[model samples]
Structures are given as C-alpha cells and as structure tokens.
Target: MTPGARVAAAIEVLDDIEARRRPAADALKDWGLSHRFAGSKDRSAIGTLVFDALRRRASSAFIMGVETPRAIMLGAMRQVRGMSVDEIAALCTGQAHAPSTLTEAESERLASADLAGAPVHVAGDFPEWLEPSFIAVFGEAAVAEASALAARAPLDLRVNTLKGTRDKALASLAHLQPQPTPLSPLGLRLPLTSDGRGPALAAEPAYVKGLVEIQDEASQLAALLAAAKPGEQALDLCAGAGGKTLALAALMQNKGQIYATDSDGRRLMPIYARLERAGARNVQVRPQRRGGEGLSDLEGRCDLVLVDAPCTGTGAWRRNPDAKWRVRPGALDQRIADQDQALVEAARFVKPRGRILYVTCSVLREENEDRLAAFLAAHPEFKSLPARDMAEQAELPGLVAFASRFGEGLRLTPLTSETDGFFIAMLVRS
Candidate 1:
C-alpha cells in the first residue's frame, strides 16, 4: 500500500480505539482481520502510524484545533514525522484509497503547528489529570520527562547468564548491531525501526535458545539492586511471568531457592515455560491461594523479598502509547491500594534483617516514595535503605545520580535514564 493509504488506515484504527475506549492492539487486529488484503508490511506500517498518532495525540489535536482522528493523523505528520505542509498535502490528493484533499484551514494549521501556548498535558502528550502527579515527582523537568515518555523506546534484552555470557549472546545477535547498555552489565540494547517497530526477535536463535530475554534496562538495574546472594533464600511475592525471578536466579547462580508467585494464577503460567527455557533451576513456582493464605510456610523465613508491585505503567508509554490516555484518576487510587497490600505480603515473608526490594514500573511519587514512607511509618520494624549505597554495592555507581529526592530510592525515567520509568527502593526488616 502507498504511504497515504497507510495513513488513512491508521486513522481508521485510531477512530475505532477512541470510539470504543479499547486497546489499540485489539482495534488493529480486528481491522486486519476484516481487511485481509493488507499485507504484513502494510499492517505494521499502519500500526506504527496509529501509535505515532497516539504518542502525540494531545498536542496534535491542540495544533489542528480539532479532535477527529484525521486531524490527529495530519497533525502527527507534522509533529512526529516532521513532514512539511506541502509534503502532507501531497499525500492527501483525493486519489484512490488516499485521504481527502487538505482544506485551506488544515493547510494553514499544518503550516504553523506551534505548541507554545498549549497546556502542560497537551504539550507533553499525556493525560491532563496526571500533570500534578508528574510535577510532584519531576518538578521543573516534568514536561520534558513526559515528552520523552511519548517518544519511541529501544528494544532491550538481558543476557541469560544461566544459558550464556553477555559477550557470547552479543556475538550471536550481532546481526542486529546490538549495543551494550550503559548501566547494567547484563543488558544489550537493540534499536527499533524508523517507525518505532522492533524486529521479530522470536525468530532469532539467541531469543529462542534463551540466551537473552526481553527486559528493560531499568528493570535490570532494579533486579541488580536486590543483591540476591548464592546461599540466600528469596521470595518473589509478585512475580508476574517471573521476569525478575529469572534475574534473581542468575544472580544467585541457581544455588539459592527463589519462590515465585503472584496474586493471580493466570499471570504465573508463563513463568513455567520461561524458567524451563532460561534453564533457571533455583525458582519454585507457587500459585496464589484465596485470601492471604499463600506461601504461609515460608513466612519470616526469607532472606530477601522482591515485590514487583503493579502500577499504572506510565513509564512504559513509549511502548504502549494508548495506555497513557486510558489511565484514569480512580486507577491510581486502586493501584495504591494494591501496592499497600503487596507490601503487607512482602513483610510477611521477609525475616529479621532481611531486605525487601520494592519495585514499580511507574514514575508516580505516590506509587514509589510515598508508598514506601507509609509502609515504614506503619511498620517501624522496617527501615528504608540508602539508595546511593545500594547503587555502589551493585557496582552501578552511575545510578546514584538518579536517586529519588523524595525518598531512599532511585527513579529512572525515559528522559533521565534513557529507559522506561521505574522506581526501586530497599527496605530492611530491623
């Protein structure tokens, strides 16, 4: 399909997404099923355009002074694709399968797509309700941080030490020109295509053989800060799919025992296959039970407890742009409640002097520092650990600069860390 036709298709998908208030992926899939003639490349291109439009949805509407999908698409061409007014006009020639010819008003709006007078959320391409939350964490840099979150993200992979070394995995995936990550020694980064699409990694031998696993650099750093030792006993209280459980297994060299479970059993199903593929021998899967009765035998017996608590996923907007808009005010309240409940579970398994690695894939202060503060206040037996010392001990001294100003933890954002937004803090049982 021609570029103009692809843009039209993307606008259609975006319309379905907004009308139904559903996920973009679902809308795109349904569109593809109905339009069977569109090839894989065409579908991919359309999906990329849809996501690009979403990334700049707020600013795009502000510039064009319209909220229609077409306006968003046209405005995105200027903001995201850097297309000139003449260039955009050429694509909308009213040709077969192409968008209608641009109106004089659209041409003028496209020519001067200035965002100087736009509101904070409009300029940042995020939900307006989140502005206060972002400011509380980022202060003067909140807008810049939000803008960065709206941009594309690079594909990151963690070298599975249980299967091979980083150097060997790098050599195997060299066809992609992977680069070593700046902070985590176990991480390798791969650039996405021009339209923010990653390669089909499942087809690669390195990924198939479990030499590498898809994980963001921020997550790698969080797992590293856990400092799980060889002879220690650890519990991954919220191990959804066991990403960190696998990381902890590698750190412990499959020597110590790591109990992996989640509040939902469905989320734990993938971990069995992942653990088998990664050759991780230390992790033991435990399905969650009704109430708070799961893992009762291990209470107060763990040397370390890792709680990868759930959040609004603001840090991952570059990968899931549609989610940023779909997030609501009530969702934050629910997530905070969930976080507090997870802390309660983590406290049960952590023995005296043992540490809990509290993690969230969110840059929101309420989910990170504020939650930790509340937990420590309620349970005086646990004291928050120093973020700088943990970084230095983890051999990632560079991360000390990213320590959270509001709490004893480190915060990583797309603008600051070139990684997904994540906040991790250590709390030791006294």
Candidate 2:
C-alpha cells in the first residue's frame, strides 16, 4: 500500500474510534476485518499513524487549526510523525481512498506549526479538566510528566515465578533478547517501538505455557508490596482477573489461602480458570450474591487485603492512548467516588494488625495521597504506612538503592520509572 493509503486508513480508524467511543486497538481490528486487502505493512503503518494522532490529539488539532480526523492525522504526520510538507502532499495526491489534498492554508500551517503554550501542556492528550489534578500531584514536573504520558510505553512482562525464574524465562525468550526491567526483579522489558509487529510473545513457549504473564513493572512492584506470607489469610478484594492475586500466590508459595472475590462475579470467573492454569492450589473463588456479604464471611480475618481499586487510570495512558481522551470529567468524579467506597468497604476485611494495600494506576492526588488522608481521618483505627519504606522492604537490592536516592510514595510518574504512572499507599488497622 502507498503512504497515501496508510494515511487514509488511519483517518478511517480515528473516525471509528472517535464516533463509536471504541479503543484504537478495537478500531484497528475492525478496520482490518473490513479491509482484508491491507497487508502486514499497511496495517503497521496505519496503526502507527492512529496511535501517534491519539498520543497528541489536542496539540495536533491546535497545530492544524482543524479538529477533524484528516486534519489531526495531517498535523501529526508533520509535527509528530516527522513527515515533510512535500512528502505529505505527494502521498495525498489524487489516488483512490487517499487523504484529500492539503489546502494552501493547511500547507502553511503544516510548514510552520507551533504547539507552544497550553496546547503543548494539553498535548498529553488527557481531558482538559484533568490538568489541575495532575498539576496538584506532579507539580513542577507536570509537563515533562505529561509529555512522557504521550509517548509509547514499552512491552513489559512478569516472569511467573510459579512456573519459572526471570533468568530462565529470559533464556527461553533469547530471540527477543528481553532484558530485566530496572525497577522490578520479576519484570522483563521488550522494545518500546511498535515496529509494526503484533505482540511478539504469543508464540513463545514460555508465554504459551504460563511461565510468563504480561504485566507492567510497577504493577509487579505493587503486588510485591502485599508481602503475602505462607499459611496467612489473604483477600484480593476487587481482584479483577487476579493478576495481583496470582502474584501473591507465588509470594506465598501457594501455602496460604487467597479468598479472591469481586462485587461482580463475571470478572472473578476468569481468575478461577487462571488460578487453575497457574497451579494455584491455595486460591478459592467466592462469588458474591449481589453485594450480599461479597466478603462478609471473611470480615476481620485477612492478614493482607489488596484493594486494587478502580480509578481514572491516568498513569497507564501511555499504553492505552485512547483512554486518556475518552475519559470525561464526570467519569473521573465517579471513579474517585468508587475508589473511596472500595477503600471503606475493603478495609473491613483486614485483620486488626494486618495491612491493606490501596493501589491505582493513576497520577491524581485525589485518588492517591488525598484518599489515604481521607481514609485515615474517617477510620482512626487505620494508619498510613510509609510507602517508600515499604517499597524498600521488597529488598530487591536495586529498588532499595533507587528508593533511597529518590524519595518515594503517592506518585510514580512515567518520567520517574519509564513504567506506568502509578500510586500506591498502604494502611494498617490498629
């Protein structure tokens, strides 16, 4: 396919994404089905354009002075994709299904486009109203932090210790030359560039045999914070698909009991099957009866309660570029409320002396440090744990030095770890 056809395909994908409120991956998949003629290279080029457009949507629109998909793609090609005016114009010639020819005005803007001022800041491609919250959390590093958010994230995978060690998994995936992630001992980092190939791990023997699971480094660290011990009672409250629960089981060496439950049984079902494949004998799936004792039976019995609460998911925007744009202001408000409620309810399951690990893939204060303050205030029995010290407790020699050199807690920006922007706070019941 010609460059023009790739641009045209990107425009179509973007339109479907914006109109149907679907994700870029889903839109691309739908487009691939409809246009079976598009080969691997064409799909790769088109996917790149769509992701680049989404990564800097606000700035692309501002630079082109047009909010339509075509204008955004054109501006992205110029400013982000680094396509020259002549190249873009030549590609957009009078070809079938090609992008419309650039007008003189569009050409001028393309030739001399400046995304300075607020647009540059907003170019993180997040909702406009979210700026203040991000500012509050990130402060002086907001723009750099936001810019990191706009960039592509690397592919990270956790070496499922249940099946194999990190070194063993790395050797098995020798062709990919996956490297040990700097932050988490259990994680491996792959290429950051898309390179037009689909997820490269699907065919690997380790991934197929459940020796490795795809998870971000920060998430691996957060799950490590739970510090599940053998013969202890652990509850993965809000265990959506049980990534952490699976991690915790490995920590416990499958000796302790993990009562994984969710308000919605549909999500927990997948975890049950995953636990089976993982050979996690200590895990028991308890489906709740529509808010009726979802965890009432385990009240005050858990040694570790992991509240992987839902939030705005601001930290993970780099991986899911479309999410940052699709999330509305009202949605954020609802998310915050949900986090508060989940914190209050999940806290009940913690044993008097046990700890609750509250985590969110968010860079917002209202969901992280602020929520901890509120929870501490409401429940005097619970006290905030020094997260920096806890992350240090992981005792992975490298992370200890990293935390010592850099102050910890509340927020982990993209710039800080090149991982997701995550916030984790721990609380212990008195």
Candidate 3:
C-alpha cells in the first residue's frame, strides 16, 4: 500500500477506536481481518501510524483546533513524523484510498501551529486530569517527563541466568544488534525498527532455548532490587505470568525455592510454559482461587515476599499510549485498593527480619510513596528500608543516587532512569 493509503487506513482505525471507545489493538485487528488484501508491511505501517497518532493525540488536537480522526492524523504527520505542510498535502491528494485535501484552516494551522504556549497536558500529550499527579512527582520537569513517556520505547530482554549468561545470550542474538542495558546486569536492548515495531525476539533460537526473556529494564531492575540470594526462600504474591518470578529464580541460580501465585489463577497459566522455557526449576507454581489460602503452608516463612502490585500503568505510556487516555479516576482508585490488599497479604509471608519488595509500574505519587506510607502506618512491625542501602547491599550501588530521591524507595522513570516508570520500596519485618 502507498503511504497515503496507509495514512487513510490509520485514520479509519482511529475513528473506529474513538466511536466505540474500544482498544486500538482490537480496532486494528478487526480492520486487518476484514481487509485481507493488506500485506504484513502495510498492516505494520498502519498500526504504527495509529499508535503514534494516539501518543500525540492531545497535542495534535490542540494544534489543529479539532479532534477528528483526520485532524489527528494530519497533526501527527507534522508533529511526530516531521512532515511539512507540502509533504502532508502530497499524501492527501483526494486520490483513490487517499484522504481528502486539507481545508484552508487546517493548512494555515499546519503552517503556523506551535506548542510553545500550549498547556502542560497538551504539550505533554497526556490527560488533563493527570497534570497534578505529574507535577507532584516531577514539579517543573513534569511536562518534560510526560513528553518522554509519550516517546517510543526500546525493546528490552533479560538473559536467563538459570539457562545461560548475558554474554552468551547476547552472542546468540547478535543478529538483532542487541546492546547491553545501561543498568541491568543481565539485560540486553534492541532498538525499535524505523516503523516503531520491535523485532520478533520470541521466534529467535536463543529465546526458544531459554536464553532471554522479553522484559522492560525497569522490571529487571525491580527484581534486582529485591536482592533475592541463592538458597533464600522467595515468594511472588502477585506473580502474574511470573515475569519477576522467573527473574527471581534466575537470580537465585536455581538453588532456592520460589513460590509463585496470583489472586487470578488464569493469569498464572502462561507462567508454566515460560518457567519451563527458561529452565527455572526452583519455581513452584501455586495458582490461587479467589479467597483461597493457596500459600497457607508457607505463611511467615519466606525470606522475601515480592508484591508487584497493580497500578494505573502511567509509566508504560510509551508502549501503550491509548491506555493513557482511557484510564479513569475510578480505575486508579480501584488499583490503589488492590495494591493495599496485595501488600497486606504479601506481608503475611515475610519471616521476621525478612523483606517485602513493594513494586508498581506507576509514576503517580498516590500509588507509590503514598501507598508505602499508608502500609508502614498500618504495619508497625515492618519498617521501611532505605532503597540506597538495599541497592548497595545487592552490589548495585549505581542505583543509590537515583533511589535516594524518593527517600524510602526507588522510582524509575523514562526521563530519569531511561526505563519504564517503576517504584520499588523494600520493607523489613522487625
């Protein structure tokens, strides 16, 4: 398909998403199923355009003075793709399968529209309601931080130490030009393609042989901060799909026991195959039914209990831009409630003097520091451990400076840490 046709397809998909208030992936998939003539490259290009449009939706609307699908696409071409007015006009020629020519007002706006004086939320490409939260976390840099969150994310992988070393995995996946991650000792990163899509690492022989697992750098670091050692007993209380559970197993060198369970048992289904692929023998899967005592046997016995608590996912906007727009206040409230419950339940597993790693993929203060404050208040026996001290003890002293900013925990952001937004606090039972 020509570039013009791809742009038209993206606009249509965006329109469908807005009209039905559905996910962009579902809209794109339905479009692909109906239009079988579109090849793989065409679909990929359209999907990129759709996501890019969503990422810059607020800014595009602010510039174009309208929020229609066409306006958003046109604004994206100018703002994101760096296309000029003439370049954009060439694509929207009113030809077959092409968008209509831009109106006079749109052309004038494209030529002169500037974001220099736009509101923070508009320039940052995030929801207006979230402005205060961003400000509370970043202060004067909130807009810049939000803009960074709107940028594209690189593909990151964690080498499975249980099966192979990072150097070995890097050599095996050399064809993809993987680079060592800045902070994670076991991480490798692959740059996204020009079209903003990541390589199919899952299909690579190295990944098939359990050498690497696709995980964000922040997540890898969160597991690292847990400092799970060899022969230690660890528990992943909310181990959905067991990403961190597998990382903990690799950290333990397959020598210790790692019990993985989730409140929603269905989320644990994929962990079985993943653990097998990664050769993680130390992990024991304990799928839980609602209100069931799945880990009753191990209560008050674990050396570490990792609660990768649920959150608003504000930090992952770089990959799932549509979610930034769809997230509602009520959803955040529900996530906070869920995090509180997960922390309380996870605390039950930590032995005396043991640690509980409280984690969330959110940059919001309410979900990170505020939640930790509330947890410490309720559980007087547990005291907050300084994140820097924990990082130093874990042999990751480089994280000390970054972790120091949050006082009691470490907060990683795309702007600050070149990683996904993650907040980790280590709590020790007295």
The candidate that wins on lDDT is 1
Q: Tell me the tens digit of each residue's lDDT in model 2 across 370-389.
A: 77777778899987766456
Candidate 1 global TM-score = 0.98
Least well predicted 10-residue stretch by lDDT in candidate 3: 398-407
Tens digit per residue, CA lDDT, model 3, 116-173? 7888899999988988888878889988999999889999999998787888987898
Query: Which run of 10 residues does model 1 get worst, by summed lDDT?
Result: 134-143
Ranking by TM-score: 1, 3, 2
lDDT of each: 0.92, 0.80, 0.91
lDDT of residue 72 for candidate 3: 92
Candidate 2 lDDT score at position 319 = 77
Q: Candidate 1 vs candidate 2: which has greater TM-score?
A: 1
Clash total of candidate 1: 0
Candidate 1 structure lDDT? 0.92
Q: Sort the candidates on lDDT, descending order.
A: 1, 3, 2
Pairs of residues at least 3 apart in sequence or in different chains that clash in candidate 1? none
RMSD of each: 1.0, 2.6, 1.2
Clashing pairs in 3: none
Instruction: Give the Cα RMSD of candidate 1.
Output: 1.0
Candidate 3 residue runs with Cα over 4 Å from true position: 404-406
Residue-by-residue lDDT tens digits, candidate 1, 93-177: 7786999999999999998768988878888999999999888887778879999999988999999998999999989999999
